[model samples]
Target: MNRPTPAADRTDRSKRTTGPGPRGRTAGAAVLGRAAALGGLVTVLGLLPWLSGKDPALALLRARSAEQEPTPEALAAIRADLGLDAGPLGLLGDWAGGVLRGDLGTSWVSGAEVLPAVLSGLGASLTLMGAALAVALALAAVLAAPVCLRGRATAGTAAAVLASLPEFLLSLVLLIVAGVWLGLAPTSGWAGPAHLVLPALALGLPGGALLGRLVADALPAVLAERWAELWRGAGVGRARIVRAALRRALPSLLPQFGMVAVGLTGGAVAVETVFAVPGIGRTALGAAKAQDLPLLQGCVLALLALGLLAGGAAAAVRRGLLGPALREAALSLPAPLPHRGSPAVLLALAGLLAAVVTWGLLRDPYAVDLTARLAGPSAAHPLGADALGRDVLARLGHGAATTVGTAAAVTGLSWLTALALGFLPGTAAGLAEVANALPPVIVGMVVAAVTGPGTAAAALAVTLVSWPPLAAHAAALAQELRASRFLQAQRALGASPFWIATRHVLPAVAGPVARHAMLRLPGVALALASLGFLGLGAQPPSPEWGLLLDESADYVERAPVAALAPVVALGLLTVLAVRLSHTAVRLRPARPAPTSVHTEGKTPLATPAQ
Candidate 1:
């Protein structure tokens, strides 16, 4: 037998020499390690007290009773049981260790296993989300297909208007009209499928608006492509062309749909509350208000995981459908040349950065102020002010900025956090799956109750809710890219996990991630504003849109413009943001051609020759 080096060995050698910097791997490892540590902390918070007989409920009870009288022995026992006897640092260390071992405690109120309690609530939420997603997808298929194929203006406009309606408002209307007025379903309660309709509609309507736009916008361009044209000439029928069209459109669309699904999962929290559903969102809301620490922590973990799962599923679907294309595309990109800084490249980057900052500043939502207070569109204020003597323009700008900024920041942070959570060796996938099925608003409300409302709490809440999608996306993309030969080759060469994730996986996912990040901004803002409007966020004098709505609720008759202005502004901002991002992504340069140098020079390429 001829002795030869194994293919894996050769590949390993090649990758070791070609992979990313040692410094990047070290840094990524550190970051991911911290993430794992934090997840441990969260999980420990879930399990520690219950296992030790000092659960959140008992602790609260002990504290309350102690305040009322001198319960020294009881207090000492509670402290001992909680391992407070070990001191804070020791307590932290012990908790961290247990968490690493997957000992998430128990629900304080229910005294149930954290995972089971979370899963129970998650089951209901997922059912609702599934129903909503099914409806939304069906609607998108029906409405978007016609619009894309023919620009069916009427259907398109109706779709647009349908999407333009706010989720809470829509839910309320449906609940009243269909559930109460028509007596078709219960107005509240977590009964069977009937209880799902209004909430499903609430979730689906906004999602439909987004999906319809994505399909209508993405499909037309894909259909207009040269491959689609060639397929037509090759005697492919319209139905087949449409199916083929999905391949091109999906890479762009799936990521976005995933983000929206992540967001809608969070939005369902409030809807669940309104409808008195016993899902995680409702449970979380109650837990937050009651200061039920274990329950709240569990809910946050669950939401984070859920967001990741949804994002991951979308990524998986995309990869399944387009894996071959992605693999081929990876092969086509020019290998990175040695990094000598180029002035031209630097200038282009700087100009692009400047343009972005400038656009954000000019659109500084806080600048538009209406001078009159509750006045119906006087010359000075196009959109009248509300109860406070603030400028409508100024308030609108601030609120818009608040909504957009808060949502963007929260979504980004949570996703990053979730990425960290999912980066762990084994638990990430399970955590993401659990998180995808939880409700975000419930998490938000719970956090609000604990940390106190205002931006910080809201941000934390949003993070808990939003992080999972990012995790899911990153994880799935990582999984997909792993199938690429470039990656397989690198891995065979001994490239570390961090190296693969950061250098190879990240670069490929940058565009899709950025597009999705932009897509989710409006929804986050909407959720924040809606929460604020309901007096569940931002407190008084923040100039937030939701707060303005709350203040103007009573004055809708006295000055309709003040109330309607904010509503209109919120709706317009969301729709425009969706449109702008969708357009920009659709217009991005196509991935470099996957295959090159066709042997037959005259043979028709998938893309037409100019």
Candidate 2:
């Protein structure tokens, strides 16, 4: 028998050792690469605007604001202060230099160093986001645990229904009905614990609903597992079985909290704004409106950071709890798909919001004579008019329009901002994540307070709060697609990243993004309406939905319908969008990947010839 040569043995060992080590190295490289990319992006994000002295929409904005051009002296001061006089790359270098020296520049408006101002805003945003997330987690546990335990179709259905409604809309409606109409809580101002209720609810509802679904989905699977069956066969108590199942489901399920958190953050901005809560989301809004590039950039960067942290936390938790299969599956799954359709739905929604604005502008809410007002609802106005005696129907319709309109506009604008940010190299995704982790109401309050109030300001505030999730998702999806074979093929075919993202990946992910976006509409609408109701949106007599509800609260006994109309519309629109998203996913045919497991042929320790 011939003995094996050392070279052959070494080669064989090398082949055998390539399993986990190579994969581990690859993962390490990926992590390092990601870190480097993020670092580079952070540097660029901090510097680029200062270098260009322009925002992404600077041209369009400048064209509109030509009359408001800064004087040469002011411009020079601004340029010197912002480092815009330096060439673009040079400015980037200067900004980078300043950053290294711990100088983030001062706020153009405040004259305070940018880092401290940013830190303060960041702290407020964190506080609000943390509170909101805690509230959401608590609510999710309270609501989802019971429904999952029940394990019945009705419980599942109830959970689904709750999940279907957007957080912003639900919270806004409650804020109006519970806070304004009932006068149970302060509608606008940041009071005490009472004020937290509506905003928290706005944050918690959608998150809780999503958690419920995640738990529900995970629970049943866990319950059916061999371990669960073994425990059951061992005569474990039902409660014990539930506990075991939940324990098993924990890892698979918990990561969903991050996604839910992102969704809630999106809603919280508007809620905060409507309620006049001061926070980072509001600051971001102010920055966006003022085109305070540094402030806006800071806000975006902060948002992305928060998202990364949340996502990372969720991932860590998930990995700690769940099996590899569950972890991979949960992370790999794209957000639930949305219905296939044109931008028509979005456009229509925009129109509706616009119509409401027009109505509010046109309607003379002051003309109603108090002497003509009856204590009860009359035929002239089936639903009793407000103290102003404006037709309640018109008011309600217009209110719904304004509230929903503002939300729609904000959502659209926010999504666009998010998309743009997502496309940027480096820190964009992280910034998006941070934004997603924030609360909209807080953003709104700060922006409104600083910039003062107007449609432009309000819209900007809404967008700042609303855009993070969309950006995170877009960036995430793009990253994922970039890794896929199809994308690689396109790249090999000489397609640019932009072209690939726009042509192939966008179409593939559109259904899901659209669904998510649609699902978000009601919440946005509700938040917007809540703002109107609170008298922060479009101002008084704007006939905003939330405002109408607030105004009609006293007359609910006389005109329940008037008070309920806006609520009903909000609810219906939310339901329709959610359903369409669900249906889109359900209707799509599943395409399974081909599985192949390599079979190794075993050789005897020694060949018979040896």
Candidate 3:
């Protein structure tokens, strides 16, 4: 053996301490990439007024006085006053400088200081989210306990069903059932504690259900570990064993909790809108509708920061849970086992969806009858008539196509983008994380600001934000696959990277990613519907499901069936998506489990009687 010289040892130690290793370089690059992405987002937001192609000065003049017409002198003075004459770069610089100084500027429409208004809205949203998170954790414990203790199938099924209901639809149901009929909670406003109940429940229930399912799936694995068996053999109490198992399982849940937190932030838009809570989500939607660029920018930036903070907090908590010993360890749980449904149940759901579509397609969704406005369900209108006397059944039928079709298109585009970027070496991961920080509603607000609110803008916004999850999933799977023995064998045999990726990696990754995307279809549809409900997608008379819901909300007490029609349709759609996504997973070919671990260049041989 050769010994290192003293100078060499010192040089090696210095290099170990100071050199930028692969991990260090990756971290630096990720930070720079995130910074660049954030800067680019701010720049785009700053340029929105110019991108809209509408003269802000003229709009301001009209807003100040509708009868006023724009003149060159007046326009020049207004532009100078508003700092528009400084051009896009100058405006961006000023906004960036203001942000650094804790000044968020002012609302163009309301003339209110943006910082205070945004802070107030953010406070309301944070309160709602905090309450919602508590509800979620409590619900998760309740739902997971039965499954963990008794392996109850019904508990899991209940979780899945509850998780399938979109937040907006659930909010409406809770509003009607709890607020209107039972009078257990207030229907709207953020005046007191009672006002928070329904909205928090609407947001929390689904999240809790989803979290429960994940916990249920992961806890069994933790309980099956060798250490758990040892504890049980030592005559430990069942409750004590469970407590230890839960602690062991919790770190696996942190990523999901982060996602849930981010989801709650995004779901606030529809929930707050339904409940009339003056939160940042609703404020951003209102700003988009009013073309208040400054206010919208502030709201979106605040949301972005909240999303990042949530992600970071979850990471910190996970690190704390794992402790120093296992800080760098990667742990993953098995996917939830697919639920098998009876053929009769599947047929019933299919029939319900088909009947609604066929019934609506036969009638004219656009036709109006003033005399029968807000009519109850009858022979002429199977579902009832809306405030405009439009056939609710027909609109439900046509709106399914508008809503589902748009969601499908967005999903396909997003899936394609995910596949394209999934294999990138270093940058895709960081970019995906940055992109995931933006909620679809915030993106929709920006798109609507530029293109005007419509189905196209909704689709674009959803597509932009939707790809990150799938891309991240794909990248992770691809990374794992690349390190497998079979892939290494192919590499040893001199297979080209492209050939191996296409032949081996693509097949391995695509099915799982596709199923993941399919599982997200209902979310995509809900997002589109949320935008429509906010008047940012599929405008009136288009018979879009969300637009129909928005239109029926005013007359819901008188024409409950009108609202119920679309709600049922959306619920059924969500159920269908959940069923199909799971069915696809179950139907996929299963890969054989490895019998033993293999070293790089070694094979195990029998010990031959030792």
TM-score: the better of candidates 1 and 3 = 3
Ranking by lDDT: 3, 1, 2
Backbone-clash count (model 1): 27
Full ranking by TM-score: 3, 2, 1
TM-score of each: 0.59, 0.60, 0.87
Cα lDDT of candidate 1 equals 0.58
Q: State the TM-score for model 2.
A: 0.60
Highest lDDT among the candidates is held by which one?
3
Candidate 3 regions off by >4 Å?
1-33, 61-70, 147-154, 334-338, 476-520, 583-610
Each model's number of backbone clashes?
27, 33, 0
Writing each residue's lDDT as its tens digit, candidate 1 over 1-610 gives 9755799788888888986664355345545544664465454444433433333535544445546443677656655665667754676666566457765555455555666767788888889888888888888787666854663323544454456455655665566557755888887887677778788888776676657755775566567668878987999888878877666666656756776677665666667876877888766666665556567666766776676677679878877876765732332212211212345643554454334334333433333334445677655554565655445555666655666677778767865664454344234434433333434454456556545567777667556545444454554455567678988999899999888888877677655656655555655666677677655678777767777766665566677676666665655544443343333333323432211111100000000000
lDDT for residue 210 in candidate 1, whole number 0-100: 57
Worst 10 residues of 2 by lDDT: 601-610
Question: Highest TM-score: which candidate?
Answer: 3
RMSD of each: 11.7, 12.3, 7.8
